[model samples]
Target chain A: MTIKHGGNIYEVAKKYGISEGEIIDFSANINPLGIPNKLKATIISNIEALKNYPDPDYKDLVTAIAKYNNIDEDFVIPGNGATEIIFKIVEAIKPKKSLLLAPTFLEYERALKNVQSDVIYYLLNESNGFNIDKNDLLEKLEDDIDLVVLCNPNNPTGQIIEKDTLVEILIECKNKGISLMIDEAFIEFVDKEEEHSLIRCLADFDNLFIIRALTKFFAIPGLRIGYGLLSNKNIKKRIINKKEPWTINGFAAICGDVLFEDYEYIKKSKEFFRVERENMYSELKKLRGLKVFKPHANYIFFKVLEENIDLKDRLICRKILIRKCDNYVNLSNSFYRVAIKDKESNAELIKAIREVLYED
Target chain B: MTIKHGGNIYEVAKKYGISEGEIIDFSANINPLGIPNKLKATIISNIEALKNYPDPDYKDLVTAIAKYNNIDEDFVIPGNGATEIIFKIVEAIKPKKSLLLAPTFLEYERALKNVQSDVIYYLLNESNGFNIDKNDLLEKLEDDIDLVVLCNPNNPTGQIIEKDTLVEILIECKNKGISLMIDEAFIEFVDKEEEHSLIRCLADFDNLFIIRALTKFFAIPGLRIGYGLLSNKNIKKRIINKKEPWTINGFAAICGDVLFEDYEYIKKSKEFFRVERENMYSELKKLRGLKVFKPHANYIFFKVLEENIDLKDRLICRKILIRKCDNYVNLSNSFYRVAIKDKESNAELIKAIREVLYED
Candidate 1:
């Protein structure tokens, strides 16, 4: 069964008979910096872009993406969002047996299953900080596994694998003729993102497929533009042949032309997240009966120390929404995730958790 | 091979060293009325809609579509475009063998091919006016054919199937355990559309599936919003389960909130097309070497009488683009389709054709 995702403020608003504006949403890990001003200006000025069919080839968008990533245009495959990219890449590979991290982005498992791929899980241990251990995972890299999908700064945990370790796995997978698909959806939120990202390794490793999203970092989840990069021209050709035309809407198709060039916005957002993430983490740790984990991305994941507490429901009483991670594989009702929002919102979130835990 | 679709002024402009604004695009049959002003205002006002994830269920949008069509909301499944609906419905059915009109929408064949379905075409005869004869079609619905796909006011021909004939096909399909998928993308352009639409028959016939697009009618093809209507709850649930989330971007999602309410725009556009389609059809018949087919929609279909003329290339010399129908099955190099634009544009199109055929 597919677990309903969080960040559905619309559903909550309707259910509670309140306006969407009234609720504080920390469920989806979206950037607090909001959409870039330049992009908004671009969209309004070019509102007529929707007047005709989007360029099916999306030449300008592709060129921008290629330039942004410093990768060849041939390596990029744009999608409606990173979600569509996930499904498309899986469909392209058609793996028989795939390996994924437990409590990772749920979409990867869903995408794999859609292709009738059997999924194997490598459980991240709480005792070991929910971090992927190199040798431990390497042991699970049996000959039978055809594909390995990793979510960098993995969802619900916010822990990222070091570049060297990631490269080791990539090399091993290559030797075993296994394709490694890494989702960099939140890679931009992490400090020194390039060090953690394997996108630069694409030319060196034909087996590597990296998926990235403008949704989370740019905070335009509703606009829907993301892409996958791979050096394999053969698979890329096959994917283009099978994929639907113009899946990316007009606004999304042209966003790359302005978004990649927004250097000030990118730098400011990076610095803001760097400060807010640490502040939120420290504040959460001050509360009683809460085990807060160190977060690398813009969201923090932790477990409730107290038993029989209903932390999520309690926090929701204050109209703040956070993700309950129990639905993820190998996770329990004790685990929860919350976005690192703006400074004021983050403080309110910390205070709410404090009130829910100690005041009640 | 997938035929590259027309109306890509982007590709044509780049190749010809001309700006997109310089060319006259008639290859894509978009409404000359352009986008509704009310929807554009709504989008500009709610620019923040793109800041967060769109409603995963798209309740408001779905409600609007249901109310607009007078169909129960349960029967509606929204997609990025009518093209996406084509692919999704075919994927859900997974038919082993399907029947399609030879010169219908190319996407159906592509969608069918994606599912590894064996496609059999019923070649539309020129002598029959490219019309589907009830008896001729019924005979082709052998035991092996599980699906039948039709493009009403059939593409590149603009010939429509009457309600009585369509009902007969639907009933026969239901009796044979075959699903009849009809593309009503051009139905809105047809005179007295309700009389030809199968939407009313959806309640009575479980085998009936209908697709409609806001793209052509609203002239927002780049925004990409369309839907499928089916009485089958089981299939609807399955499609939703397998489908990716938020394929429709935010602007497309919210446009429905305002668009369906723009009754004046709808009425005016219908009247405009009514006058323009006829005017263009009558004017085209005056051309020296063109055999004009009576158009039931906003586009006219015709065949060049002259031999070895390269009509499409000749028109390109004047920067006037019309769909070259030769790429479509059963359509020869002589076949072409052109959209009916506003008065001045229509005259220029006819004048250009006259220049190509007679003046040259």
Candidate 2:
């Protein structure tokens, strides 16, 4: 089977000749609490919305997102997903030279390459828990660069840049006349999300752009809803001008207002992740021949110390799927990522990994 | 009220202080038959699919589209909408010079402008019932052009380019090394879809591309599913390489296979449009000061011969909405387009127009 960016249970299910429901998926970092009851009820009731075109401007959705983010409605640009926003920003910016982090979410590189933007990676040191070095990163934001992207509670490693350091980088980019795009797709899963998100910085920094998605936190990845925040009115105008109309379907369009207001689901999800992430992290740390990185989000990342283990393949035999991190730049076959799911599923994954590594 | 592309019942409802369902929508050209029962059942039954990420490759959806069109699976590139595919193709091609119809679907111009492609228009002759001249159009396909776009059974005018004429243009484009994109978004609404569609020619012509959507014939515009067909392997690969993953949501992904297989819905829809389109055309022509163009699709385009009639606004007072075509590049305020809804709605629209023009 071809290696793919994870959460591909369809492929795995076909390969194993089993139903998709049989596979315990830890490959995609989604809120394991699942879709909020309120949102689901709302969507089911409004199913007839599929008959008409979605509101091209997506006014109600944008208004709700802006209210939730505490930013001006004018600052918000909603998209099909955070991925769409990422590509649109690159297209709008058409940057000559952009800076990215190695082993980040793979979509950024794809988006940059689409616009023929020269990409330079700022390698995060594994010794520092795959964290960005503040001074070193600031030094690299020279006048020559047109764009700089940072993913908070970053993918694969589940590490984050310090708030002060991120602010400093944003200021440096502003000073150097470079556009700063901060992808906070996983920010909601992090504790104290307000402190880690640059959404507040949008009021002061015109060059700062932040992207957020309901797919991860709301557990509605299939719904495809995300928004970009920027105080730069010109960029916002350009995006609106250039964007295709009604990319968000009517069902997804109404989700922001309903999902953002589901405080019960939000509270329950945070609590679940808070407890499960810690339990899974500690359990995995107990295993031999594994070096688990402390995770800040819903997923844990680790490197295998033993040779020729083939953990992903072995786990698949037990009807478990975990992300193999080899495809990620600067990460090798020995590295892997797994989502912290429900307690029972997490325990099953732990048992499967133990059987593969220690027993045989 | 700001002039917008029609079918925006949200804005209209707000402006009139009325519920959306109260207004009869004629602005958007959707099937009068409404959403297929099979598709609705499939979507509702699989609502839990929203818990997982959509397959990034959208293999099932693409395969279904290919099988339905009798084309190669590799030739299909599914997107959020026909609109998204339009933007992606334009971005990928980066055409130096492109040709389009003056009063075509508005999104093509927006897509072309996004890539800074020089747009040249072939104005349909108003004197000839807004139809394209075959010989004249062929003469305009010069070697300097990089891309050519055709909207079959053209929007607003409801006219189709002859199949033979279209084939000649395709051969001409191939000889000139110009890429041809035929948008068949409304083709399923046409009486003879098999003859009108260019899907069969894709295997032979590398330069030929066609865009299709379930939004129209399937009556699921709010669902947002569309696919592009092209035999050009390089172009398809480039699009896949550049495209952001999971543009099609999971619910929309499963739709292609189910919806395309709904032959009962397909037969009912075609029969409905065939009868209603003709009935409405004859009814519209009976009006004293209206010139109704012969329609090939599910909508009728006509001109109000009298000046200062304000047909759209006057009908709006009667709680009916019709597309005022002044926003189209070469269309004027006197021109209007209306969907061929069910018999009752069609009668009400005809009655409203007669009342507005004759009584007032």
Candidate 3:
């Protein structure tokens, strides 16, 4: 079978001979609160804005992002999504040798390959709960490396590197003349995100780059809005020079202002996840044949201990979909990841898993 | 002065110290009929779709484009806009030497420059009304050139190369192992577009590539949907492999099936443009010091015969925006382009120009 990303309900529905709306998707880590009411109202009111072209410079959108992050306007560059910005950065840097985490997001590898950059992997050990070992990681950041990527509250595993440790790595990368990129796509879901984010360090470290997206936290993955931050003047200039204009659509461009200001939605989602993530993790840990990793974001990662268990397939049979992490490097078929949904859905998933595992 | 492209109403509004809604935009060549009513209704009804991630494969959108064009599904690839596809194709082909027309759509050059490809221009002569000379163009197709880009019913100048001449160029490109990319972005606005389009010849010419967009014809530039077509399996495979998933927002993805099926909107737009374009051209020709190039698209290109006339600024003073061709290569301050809008707006533009030129 081909490696697949989550949120692919079209293919999954066909495979299971079921309607898409019937399948409960725990594969993608989107906020359970869903699209904000204010955003929906904004879309309806400004529907006519679709007739005109989006601002080529996307000034309003960038201003909103800069204000939200409390960063300089020069540091913000909005894109079609985090994916486009990743490719643009790789193209601009044209790094000779780059280092990435073994079980990280797949697009980093694909973006680097597009620019013909030689990539080396620093494998995160499963024994350490998929967390990077500071000393081991430092050893891999040799003078020969030109770029290094970190995914904070990393996908699939949902583990975050401590702030001080990340700072040490950043200083080491700067000493070695290597650029460090931290993808904080899921950072907003982490408790005290401002403390964990490296965005503040950007002013002092010219070598640091940070990527953020509204897809996961804002619960609007369908809108496709993401931005990147960097204090390096030369690299930022190169990216802007190479970028295609108006990559963000009108509706997506308008989203940064309204969605980020949605305090009620933000507070409610964080509050829900704060309790639900723990409950979901504890329940899954009760099952005798599974080991659930402590989750820092809106998803949990786990390993099936029973040798012959096909947990993903079993859950899918009950109209539930969980991400099979076998495709990730350094991971085997027994590993899986699932999003922490709302109370009712999480309970339903837990019930289904218990029934499937205990029946045989 | 910084180089500017049309449809930058945001920047123009700021520069003129006026609101965006107050400015009459004749700079962008969008359909005067505005956003199709059906599209507006669909967007309102499907507002909740924004919570879900766009299909990574975009299978349904691609299928709709293929069906609309009467081509095989394998030949289609949807993008954020034509701009994204242009950059992707440049990256995939990695052309050593590319040939482009002078004073064409500027994004093509930017896309090629991003890949560090060597670009050679075939300057369109003003003596020939900015249209390519068949024999002269044929001679420039050197065997060493790897790629050739053409914009049919071209931007700014609004002149199209004859169908027979385009076919000849395609044959030569194929024979010399060069890729031919024809941008049919404005082809839908042309009468009998089927007779002039190279899309149907894809089965016979594997080296041919065509780019199209709904931004202009559907009056939805804010939505940002465009696509590319080619029968070359190898190139298509490379593009898909290198493409970042979900570049299209969910709303834009759903637009393919809805907008393409709006027959009433399509027929009315064609009928509207067929009359308005001629009226605008004839009215502009009545001025004493201007030479209008007969338009084949929704915009008309003209030259100010008299010196020291800042037509763009003068129109701006009247709260009307027209594109200045000074930034385009092989063109000067005397040249300008304006869109054929609704009858009232077109007449207002004509009145503004008359007062600025003859009355002054």
Candidate 4:
């Protein structure tokens, strides 16, 4: 009966009798730069907006998002979060059977279940650093699977599907009448995002759906805003027809104008991550009991060696929380994931892990 | 397909070239005392919380809600808003043929449609002031219908069902294997919410599902928080299993503690509304070309005289927006609904209407 996702800091804080702010949370992969200052100032000054309901149409927000992505306004459907769009897409598609990568974002499976849609998995071998081999994925798509969800810069592993591989899969899926939904929720953190993203191909592929989130890169998970971009008119209509008005809060609607256009924040974030991710990744790799996967995004996925430690509990004991990968369909308890935090925090995490793993 | 809900003051303000703060919005029936000061202060101080993800489990929020409602924590499932709960409940139940009150909150039908469920209506009669007729409803609750939704103090028309009628319906539904859902969203504004609410009956009726919202009562719609209450363990499990984690935002989760426990705000709001509603109802009743329905909640529903004016267009000219009930099933363009606002605003609304109907 426990909620099945990350970012339960309140519960974690209570269990350890610590302030929520005191915990270094890696359970959720949110941007470490925090809310953009401009966005913060806008929200603070416009706190009274909470008194009114959000625009039911969300025209301004949609237009802002469309302009940012250089897409048609009709292609966007903003939601409570990327998760809401995911759930709605599944409901709208009504696929009899869907295919997903093993150990991907846990929510796609939950969304599939909500529609009572059966799921088929294309397991990514742990030895391959959890990368989706395109040939294997295309073969798994076969014919009858109508929906395929790919978590690009995939959660937990932070391993993304390469451009050539993604293009092949998209072409194959289109030929077979299968819808390919790419969750690019963490894409902004990935270096050379333009190279891996299918966003540019959305206009050419009616069967492709792209999910984006402001909660992560914009560092406003508390505001609850995300959207789906797709070219399928029928599916778009079905989603809009099913959506609840004002699902995106008023404060969140203003966020696109503030965060997306905040060039300084974006540039600073990229620069910080360019240096910090490698630092954190190498530091974790240096640890004796863990195998850190090569990360493409802002988080590193690593496995605890069976011989050395209960990594999750060890980290929790130090008042730092990380996501245990056991709940993921294909992963075991030995695997864990942590966000590649800033320099000082990364050092603290490395220090904590060393203390926990190296001690007698 | 424009989303058919009101209180989009931000967008309305933008279109009308008015600041959102200047608009006297009577579209949403939120507490007329405006945002609770304590809740406002809490949000301003915890502005930094937007940097973090909301508690995925919403443990503290749930506990506060349980305490407020005097129910077991397990029986409640919080949502992004009451709308999300409605959407989730329909998906969880996967009802084959559902019966919804015509002229009720629009989301009920939309949610049912998302599941591709067949929806039938028990149309409320104009002669009855849109109140639920228990015998008529009981007759419509055939064994074939898996679900029935009632908006007590029903939207568009603020008529409430008495406790005895609701109890009889609940017991009958249980006997007939029908799931009865009561949306008590506006019940808090009623003189005796406890007496009229099926929340007490929740302990006894496994067949009953009660939907409640903190938005209208607490005046925090922008935060997007609401909860569903049901004693049926099976239904509760189904909902929990299907929910998107972190659906409620951090600011919203904190609201369960701040607003639910703020006795001073609650007392002052109720007092203000008790006087304002009576005054507004009397004023509207006296006005020509409008027939006012008796209101049990924080809004008034009335029909414009056919020969005199188009109320919606007239109100729009005055920069006032009221919900045109035409979009609601069983309601027509001649019908409109308005919120019971604060004393000064209520008087302003009355004067504007008088000028439109009499002087113009």
Candidate 5:
């Protein structure tokens, strides 16, 4: 009955009898530069919005999202978060059989299950550094698969599917009359995102569905804002028409307009991650009992090599929280994912890992 | 494919070329007091929570809600809003056949449709002030009906089902092995709510499911928080095991603790509605071209007497927004509903209606 994945800080805090505010968590991948000051001030000054029923049509937010992604406003359907969008799209399509990647986001499976769709997984091999090879995937995207889901810069691994590879898959799926949903939730954190994103192909590929979130990079997960982009007019209409009113809260609606266009926050975030992700990856790689993988996003995924220590338990004793990847399909107890945080916190995690691994 | 619902302020504002902030909206029912000052302060101070994911299990929020409602903590499941809970319950149970009140909240139909459930309605008679006849509804709950939904102090009509009627239905449903869900979302605005609410019946009836919302009563619809109370352990486990993590945000999580105990706001809101609902209802009753029903909640429902006039269009011209009831199953363009607002706003609505109805 335990359905929880990550970010259960209150449970972790209470079980350990520590204050939630005191725990330094790297369990969930979020923007390292905290909340944007401009967005914070906007939320505080416009606190009155909580009283109003959010616009059911969500016109302005949709317009803003459409403009940001260079898509038609009619093709955009914003949700409470990317999670809701995933569920809605799955419900609307009602695919007979769905194909998902192993060690992917859990919500995709949950969403498909809601529609009673039979699901099969394309296992990503750990030996290949967990990266998806396009030709291998396209071979599997036969006519029998009604839908295919691919997460860019995949979670728990921080591995990116190459741009040309994605285009090939999209073209093949289109030829086979299959729907392709690409979850680009962490794309903004990847260096040179334009090379890895499917936003450019959206105008040409009606079979593609791209989900983008303002939660992570904009640092407003508590506000719950995300949107989907597609070129298929009929599919977009079906999804939007079936949605519940006010799925995007008024605060989140306001956030989409302001944060999506907040270029200053964007610039600052990219610079911080570009420098910090590398620094954290390098520092962790120096440890004797750990293997740090090359990360393309804000989080680094690593595996413990030594047989004597329980890495997740040792880190928990030190009041450090990192995601244990055991729950992910094909991932074992030795795998862990940590968000690349500020210099001080990175130092703390490094020191704790060294102390736990080297202690005689 | 047009969805009949409210809370799309962004779309309406753009359609009419009006700034959303300028429109006096009555289309969606919400508390007039806006976000609590303390909650606002909490959100601003805890803005950094946006940098981290919300606690997946929502323990603190659930504990606070349990304390507020005087129930066991395990009996509740808090959600993004009441809508999220409603969808989850339907999916989990996968009811064989369901019963709904016609012209009630529209989301029930959409949720049922997602699961492909057979839906039948017990339409409320307008001649009877839209009241539910317990005897008639009981007879309709035949052998095949797995679930029955009741919106107490029902939306759009503002009609309250008697306490004894709910008790009789609850007993009947339990005896017949059927689950009954009573949505008390707007119950706080109704006088003698404790008498009509099934909140206390959870221990006695395993088939009872009560849905409550912090959105309307606390005036934080933008925060998106609500919960479900049920005594059935099996159903509870199913919902908990299938839901998306962190559906409720951090500020909303804290809000369950703050607003539930905010005695001042509760007192002020109750007092304001006690006086204002009566005045607004009386004024509408006096109108020359409308038949206004007695309102037990913070909203009044009415029918246009004159066939030549479009009340929704006229009200829109006066910069006032009211929900058109034509979207509801049994309702038509002749029906409309408006909220009981502050004294000044109430007067403004009354004056506009008089001019539109009686003026040459």
Candidate 6:
């Protein structure tokens, strides 16, 4: 069987005989505000520009990223998406033995496998609501571990590793000669993202690799643009030298032209998700048969308390799609993740999910 | 120095302090006709759809490609571009000893190098108009060579390897247990493309891999979509299993929704490039200081007869950008390739070259 990832509304839409437009997808954790109006106009205007190849160096795209993050341009490497960066980093590291957070983002494990790395997972404790214990992670970091990958505001669980905790891990890994890679794909969704992010510590940690994406927050997963920030120039050069050219599509290359600077859209989306995530989280917690983990980003994760419930199947029957987390490592069939969408969609999902629970 | 590829109007624009819109680019061999009007409209309509992740399976895309080529869907593997397919094929084959046409597309060599493959070049003799000597190439295909790559209607030289010769090479390579990859990226620009393409023989040779791109023929290089065709499902499966997911962007994936079926646009483009390529070829041949090779695609390759004249520098000063073939293997500073553009632009380029030649 294929190991499916979330955001598979295409498959669901086909299977359920529902038009993609009709389906309220709680599977993909994308921005509820959708693509910014200005970004759409920018894309339309640049349609004719598709005749030319994107800059091979992606100089302007890099500039936008560096300026947005207040980092030097040399520290940024733009990619097709954060997924591309994850794979490239693994290739550059060629880690012989790596440790990853179980129940984190799935791509890192696949990437590690590509490099033939022996992967040891520091399984996040379910009883502890899938939180990463700093001391426990440090103890798990052996000298033989060449790399450690963490998904900040970890996927399917939505538990974030605070900035100070990340620094401790970075330092411990550095001391043990292990590289640290943090994927902050959904960080912008959280309040006080700067306080939680290790961007300021980038210069101090040459071994650090931070993955960011325009996919979720900007709601352009289809456009496929993301970037990585690293202090190590050698690894950065290795990635640039090794990657396939023009991987960034023409529209995607110009995405940052409006994305990083769309202050209004950014503010509006953060505010929307902030309210929706909380409301959705509380609603899910109100359900008697679910144990909702406190969400850190734009998605809420919960485990069905009742056994053998087939909740995803039931929810799909009601034309509401939610991510079944069984495919993720250390996750089970009872574990499900639902994206916090717009107010109306959230209400529909909650109602559908409630009906499924009550019917069981 | 950076090994530059064609279609870098971005770099030229920055260095020359001219707007990219003003520069008539002859470096890239894209279709003379810009993107299809229907495609532009389809993209705009799907602007809101960018919020959703593109169908991961790309079913509609695969169907369009399969239908267009009259091949089984199993035989096709869609990629970010032909460049991505090149890299993926090299990774899947892991060829220890590979033979490639030296003046071919540069990406093949770079891809081969990534796997540390021992690259032996079949240097197309410039004195022989860069033509592939069939007998010489056959003799060079030793049993020990694991892979062989050829760019039909080869890049920078514009010489084609006919179907019969390609079949012979394929059979010989198969017998010797060597994989054969034929890149037909520019074949559509040639009249009777089917006659020159090895596509008909694909079923007979599992070792055969054909790379096709919409970049040049469809004139959407920035959109980034291409595919590789092979009869070997194992290798295809290997590629799919190993590749980074969703490498093809949303807009690029849906490109086929209009591209393959747009018979009117395809016919018009082919008609345009056919006349343009001939006119451009003849015009270049008439130049006093150049020896133009007969072109098979929408581009002409030539050598500057006069020594110590910086032709590219001179032309760029005239606000025209053409490919300097110095970076291509087995090609030198005097070598150049220029795209066959619209008639007016072609005339402008010719006039500029005439001025540069006489000025020298």
Model 1 agreement with the true structure over B293-356: per-residue lDDT tens digits = 8899988899999977888888877988888898899988899999998899899999999998
Ten contiguous residues with the weakest lDDT in model 4 chain B: B1-10
In model 2, pairs of residues that clash are none
Point out where model 2 deviates above 4 Å.
A1-3, B1-3
User: lDDT per residue, candidate 5, A70-115, as tens digits?
Assistant: 7778678888789878987887788999999998888898889867
Per-candidate DockQ values are 0.70, 0.63, 0.67, 0.63, 0.59, 0.72
Lowest-scoring 10 consecutive residues by lDDT in candidate 2 chain B?
B1-10
Q: Report the lDDT tens digits of candidate 3 across residue range B233-292.
A: 988889988888888999988878799999999999999888888888899999878899
What's the true lDDT of residue A262 in model 1?
A: 96
Instruction: List the lowest-lDDT window of 10 residues for candidate 6 chain A.
Output: A1-10
How well is each residue in B123-171 modelled by candidate 5, as lDDT tens digits? Answer: 9998888998778898998978999999988988999998888999999
Per-residue error for A333 in candidate 2, Å, reads: 1.6
lDDT of 4 by residue, A1-360 (tens): 354567777777787797877789988888888878898788889888888777788788899999998889988988888988999898889899999889899888888986778899989898888888777777788799999999989987889888899999999999999999999999988898899889999999999999999888888888888999998999998888877777787788777778788999999998888888888888898997888899888888998886456777778878889888888888988898888776788788889988888873
The sequence of per-residue lDDT tens digits that candidate 2 reaches over residues B1-360 is: 123787998899999887988999999988978899898899888999998988888888989998998878888899998988988888778899999998988888888887789999999878988999989999999899999999998987999988998999999999999999989999998988889888889999999989988899999999999989988888887787877888889899888889999999999889888887888899999998998899999999999999788898888888999999988988888999999899999999888888888887
lDDT of 6 by residue, B91-187 (tens): 9999999998888888898899889999999998987889988899999999999999999889879998878888889999999999999899999
The share of true interface contacts that also appear in candidate 1 amounts to 0.69
- Between 1 and 4, whose DockQ is larger? 1
- Model 6, span A205-286: residue lDDT tens: 9999999999999999898899999999889878877888999988888878698899999999888877878888888899
Judge the docking of candidate 3 as incorrect, acceptable, medium or high: medium
The positional error of residue B100 in candidate 1, measured at the CA in angstroms, is 0.7
Cα error, candidate 3, residue B317 (Å): 0.5
lDDT of candidate 1 over A6-57, digit per residue (tens): 7888887787776889899999889998989999999899988888888998
Name the docking class for model 5.
medium
